[model samples]
Each structure stands twice: as C-alpha cells, then as structure tokens.
Target: MRVEYINPFVEAAYNILREVMHGEIKRGELYLKSTSMPVLGVAAIIGLAGDVQGRVLVDMTKDTAIKVASTMLEGMEMEPLTHLNDMGKATITELANMITGQAVTKLHNLGFKFDLTPPAIFTGDNMEIADTGVEALIVPMILEHGKIEINVAIRERN
Candidate 1:
C-alpha cells in the first residue's frame, strides 16, 4: 500500500511494455479501491508472500490481450494471434512474469524479500475481484494496442 511499493511495479510495467510493444506507452492516473472491482476481461494474477502479502493483477480487455500477445509474438518472428489460444495465454503469462520479476528484483534491492507464485491467467466477462482487507492500487498503462491495468494489493506482513 505504500507509494514506495507501488512505484517499482509501475516503472517495470512501463519499461516492459515499451520494450516489447515498441510503441508509445502512456500511464494513466493511479487510483485506489477498497471494494470489488470489475475485471476488464483478461487478467494475470500473481501472489506475493513473506515481507509483504497480497497479489498483483495485470488486467486488460480480451482484445488488448490478443493484440499485445500478437505484437509480442511478431517481435519474435512468430505469427500473430487472432484469439486467446494456448500460445496466446502463455505469452500473456510470460509478460506478467517479466513485469513482476523486475519489480520483485527492485523490491529486493530495497530490502524487501518475498516469493511470487506463478501467474494465473483469468478470462471472463462480468468478473469482479475483492481483496478482503487490502486496498488495491491500480495503475493503468495505455498502449497503441490497448490498456493494461496493473493492480497492486500488498501490505507488510505483521
């Protein structure tokens, strides 16, 4: 919940997205939510435990996921995806891993130690997420493909 904890993820997301997408990336205003919030369509969630405990969500519309995945694949000289197939899902998962891995490294350098669970991808409509006692801070990143919302809901463990 501290600003210090959130900045790394925001910076990592921006850097990773810009590097992978090779396009203009803009960050939207950050906001907090204490109640359930709607999921855009596709989300990759990773759990953190140790010094901090909670989760991080990379949320985006299915369309955005597909486009982002396609862009990533194309960068590797692979065919772009037209749907969220297994490969597409894996690509998005890897993207989540990259962002969180970088952020965790930064956090570690700042003296916080934690373990991250593998990211799980969720896709559906009319979905909502509620973190019992933690308020989620969301940073929305806009790319030419679409927008990605990086939702962080971590608190220092007592």
Candidate 2:
C-alpha cells in the first residue's frame, strides 16, 4: 500500500492513543500479512468503501483487551477476560471506530473518499479475517498495557 493510503491510519492511532489513553505509544515493525492468520483473542473489524475499498482489523490479546478496556474507561478496573461483557467488546470496537474515523477524515482532507461500517467485534480463538484482495499491512502499536495490531488492507477502486 502507498504511504498516502497508510499514514493516516498510523498517525491517527498514535495521536488518539496519546490523547485519549495518555500513554507512551511506541510503533513497532511493520509487515505485510496474509488474512489466514488466526486473530489473537479480541478484535474489531471495520469495513471501508468508496475511493478505497477493504477492511481494518484492530487486534489484541484478552489480557490486553482488559487493560485497554480499563484505560478507555478512565482507569476503571476490569474483570478477568475469561469471558467478555458488552463493555469489553465496546471498548475495542470504539477504539477501532475512533481510529478509523480520524483516519478517514484525514484521508478526506487529502481528497480521498470513503465510508466505514460499524465495527464488528470478534473474540475467542482461531478467528480468521479474509483478505480484501490486497494483503494487509500490519502496524503494531505498543502501549503501557498491551500491543495493538492495526491491520489495514485496501485497494483503489475503479
């Protein structure tokens, strides 16, 4: 994917995490990944359509999900992640929404147009996200609590 297509998501994730979570967000190595890999424990998948078309999957482990949910809750303590409640699911789903919304806005400012679907939450083991023609570019952002993998895949539509 082009930097024009990818940087908005990266910058948005960094900026939102810094502003919302108030933590040191470290971006890790980036790479292209196939869609067949089983998503960790918790994930939110959002679809994109318009000038660009594809999906974004925000992925993390269960323990990480608990910490993220707590942080997003303004440090409210979260229960064990052996099972997830609505709030736990909403936390990550909203994170994906925030990240995607800001990135889409940035892309719009740069003259790209797109609409995003509501985030779809996925849990448990061995959940697989299908590839959207193009392979996903995985960007790992590490916070004090856990690591978030932003998997972005899109192709310019005719």
Candidate 3:
C-alpha cells in the first residue's frame, strides 16, 4: 500500500487508541509481509471496498483484548478472556469500525472513495490467515496493556 493509502489507518488507529484506552500509543517501524502470519489471539477483520479493495485485520492477544474491552466498557473488571465474549468482541469490532470509518473519511478528503463492511471478530491461538494475493503492510502499535497490529492489505480497485 502507498503511504497515502496507509497513513490514514495509522493515524486513525493512533487517535482512536488514545481516546478509547487513554494510553500513549507507540508505533513500530512499518514492514511488508509477503505471507499471512499467525495472529496473537483475537482479530477483528473488516473488509474494505470501493476505491480500495482488501481487508484490515486488527490483531491482538487475548489479554490485550480484555484490557481494551475493559477500558471501552468504562473500566469494568475482566478476567482473562478465554474466548470471544460479547463485550470483548463488541469493543474490538467497534475499534475496527471506528478506525476504518475515520480512515475512509480521511481518504475521502484526499479524493479517494471507499466503503467498509462491518467487522468480524475471530479468536483462537496462533490464528493465521491466507494471503489474498496482496502483500500486507503491518503497522504494530503498543499500548499500556498489550500490542496491537494493524495489518493493512489494500490495493487500488481495478
């Protein structure tokens, strides 16, 4: 993905994390991945369409999910998230939705148009995805609680 295509997602994630979790987000160096790698534990996958065609995977560990969910739930106490609970799933999915919605708006301002599908939350140990014929740009961000990977696998629509 071009920096033009990728920056909005990065910026949106950064902004959303800070607002939702109320924590400083540290971003790592961006890298390209040729193959899909194992996700930490939970992933909220949101599909992108219109000008860009692909998916964005917000990947994080179970602990991270619980912590983020708890924060979004107004600091509700949470145990180790063993499975994808409703509140946990809703929080993560909404994070993905907010990130994509904001990014799409930014893209619109830049003369690009796009639409997003609702997010789908998936949970499992070492969960991996198959490459969708497009290389993904992995943007890793660290929060106070855990790490979140914003995997962007988008290309200009043909």
**Candidate 2 lDDT over residue span 1-158, tens digit each:** 76797899899988888876765889998898866777888999999998878989999988888877767776554453444678878878998999989999999999999999988998988777777468898989999988989999888786
Give the C-alpha lDDT of model 3.
0.85
Which should have the higher lDDT, number 1 or number 3? 1
Q: Where's the lowest-lDDT run of ten residues in candidate 3?
A: 75-84
- The lDDT, on a scale of 0 to 1, for candidate 2 is 0.85
- Model 2 spans > 4 angstroms off: 75-83
Q: Could you arrange the candidates by lDDT from highest to lowest?
A: 1, 3, 2
Provide C-alpha RMSD values for all models, in order.
Answer: 0.7, 2.3, 2.3
Compose the digit string of candidate 1's lDDT tens values, residues 1-158: 87789889999999999889977999999999999999999999999998889999999999999999999999999999989999999999999999999999999999889899989999999999999999999999999988999999999887
Candidate 1: worst 10 consecutive residues by lDDT?
1-10
* Candidates' C-alpha lDDT: 0.93, 0.85, 0.85
Clash totals in order = 0, 0, 0
* lDDT at 15, model 1: 91
Q: What TM-score goes with each of the models?
A: 0.98, 0.90, 0.91
Cα TM-score of candidate 2? 0.90
Query: Which candidate do you rate higher for lDDT, 1 or 2?
Result: 1
Q: What is the Å distance of residue 33 in model 2 from its true position?
A: 1.7
